[model samples]
Target: MGWVTGVMVYFVVWWTVLFAVLPFGVVPEEAAERESGGWRGTPRSPAIVTKALWTTVVATAVWLVIWYLVNSDWLSFRTGWLAMPA
Candidate 1:
């Protein structure tokens, strides 16, 4: 894959990884009041820094794999799924 394609693939992979890593290690806050629980919109500790770090690492690895597949002759993305059988 070219530099531009690699970068684009990495960008998409980064965002995908971010969403996947966002829910890891999430903790819900306990409510003090018995009648009505205070369940806020945000998580107890979002851990943005940790999540971002993991996302970067995961995205890099995923991008490398995809880049290799596209550049290598082992796989061909141009092959059509609907092609008629010989």
Candidate 2:
């Protein structure tokens, strides 16, 4: 894939992974705490940095596999069964 496409793909993969990772280890704040301030569903300890790191790691691995397939032409659409009919 071209550099631009590769970057776009990575960006998408990163955000998707982030969403998937966000729910893990989440514990909502107590109702009493919510009354003091903040959103009702806010996590007491979101561990955002940790989740972001994990997301990056997972997304990188996934992106590498995609890059390999595209670069090696194993998943190429320009030829083979993936090619469009004229």
Q: Which candidate is the best by lDDT?
A: 2
Q: lDDT per residue, candidate 2, 8-72, as tens digits?
A: 99999999999999999988865635456777678889999999999999999999999998887
Model 1: lDDT equals 0.81
- What is the C-alpha local distance difference test score of each model? 0.81, 0.89
Model 1 Cα lDDT, one tens digit per residue, 16-68: 99999998999876553435645654477889999999999999999889987
Error of 1 at 31 (Å): 2.7
- Residue 37's lDDT within candidate 1 is 49
Model 2 residue runs over 4 Å out of place are 78-86
Give me the displacement of residue 42 in model 1, in angstroms: 2.3
